[model samples]
Structures are given as C-alpha cells and as structure tokens.
Target: MTKEAWDGTVTKKSRGLLDGSSMYRRLELRLTDGSTVKVRVSRDLWDAVSEGDQVTKAAGEDPVKQ
Candidate 1:
C-alpha cells in the first residue's frame, strides 16, 4: 500500500484497542487537498512519517518514463 503523511484533524474517535494489545491507536488523516482525498492512516504510519522530513511515494518514478 502507498504511504504518505498529511495534515488532517480527527473528526471523530471512539475508544478501542487492536488485537487486545495495549498499543492505543486511532484512524487519522492528512488530506492532500480539500477535494476529500484525505489520506487514511494510522498512528503507527504517522510515527514513521514523523521520523522523516517529507512523505514520499513511488520514489524516483514517473509513469511517463515507462
């Protein structure tokens, strides 16, 4: 799956745990545009992105180059 970090707010959230693990998480988003393309992501994914400067997708690739 493609991974990209975005800037979005949690519109809503409910208390829950995944696989009975103590690791708490939530469904967050960082939209690339106001066109409703909110990038669905998890807290784990956010951490990975936070460890970097910018999110990257399909690195060094261009469809037109194909």
Candidate 2:
C-alpha cells in the first residue's frame, strides 16, 4: 500500500480527533512542488473540498475536485 501521487491547492480544511474516539479528515496542501503537505482524507473527500480547491490524488485514488 505504497502508491502516491499529488497535485494540490486547497490550503486547509480540517477535522480532528484520533485517540479520543477516532475521527479524522484533513487536507492542507500547497503542492505542485512548492511543498506543504498534510493529508488524511475521506469522509467523502472531506466533504468534496473547499479552500482554494484544486486537487488531485492519483495513486490508488480518492481525492478529486479539480
């Protein structure tokens, strides 16, 4: 399970909790090589994205909105 691909813009969208009952969804990207990454997504791709909204996650799939 090591497949990775990226393209990004969405500069933050978040939710948290991960040992206090487990809940998580996050995206804080700014990639396209200008680095900055934080991704833990699902929950329908974090409610279908927001922030600056331009996203892609190819390898094995699950991020969209581009």
Candidate 3:
C-alpha cells in the first residue's frame, strides 16, 4: 500500500533491550482523525518521544521512518 503522513499523539511505547541497553522500540499512536496506528521505531527516536507527544509519521511504511 502507498504511504502518507499522519499526525498523532503517542499513546503507548515499549522497548526491546539487550545487554542492559535498549536495542529496539515501538510506538502506538492515536491519530488526529481518531484511528490507531502502531509503528516500530529506532531506540534513538523512541527515546526522543513520550506518551501524549504529538508526531508526524508515514503510514504503510516499514520501519516507521519518523
């Protein structure tokens, strides 16, 4: 499917850690239009975001290039 940008607020976040450090992360968002979307993200980007933070991201894209 084609991808598009969507604005949303982060609703949830989680991480995968290795060796006592975060290696991967994921974010779940509630879209402005009231839809839910989830995306896997890098640890750096994940660290930069928090619950209730507004963000823009491309939908239908793998790896969620925020």
Identify the leading candidate in terms of TM-score: 3
Q: Mind giving the per-residue lDDT tens digits that candidate 2 earns over 5-65?
A: 8899998888979778989888999998999998888888789878998988889877778
lDDT of 2 at 11: 89
Which pairs clash inside model 2?
none
TM-score of 3: 0.67
Question: Each candidate: what lDDT?
Answer: 0.36, 0.86, 0.74
Better structure of 2 and 3 per lDDT: 2
Model 3 off-target regions past 4 Å? 17-22, 58-66
**Lowest summed lDDT over 10 consecutive residues: which window, candidate 3?**
57-66
lDDT by residue for model 1 (1-66), tens: 443334443333333566697655333333346422323345555444432123323433311100
TM-score of each: 0.31, 0.32, 0.67
**lDDT tens digits by residue: candidate 3, 7-41:** 78899997776457656677998988999988677
Q: Per-residue lDDT for 46 in model 1?
A: 44
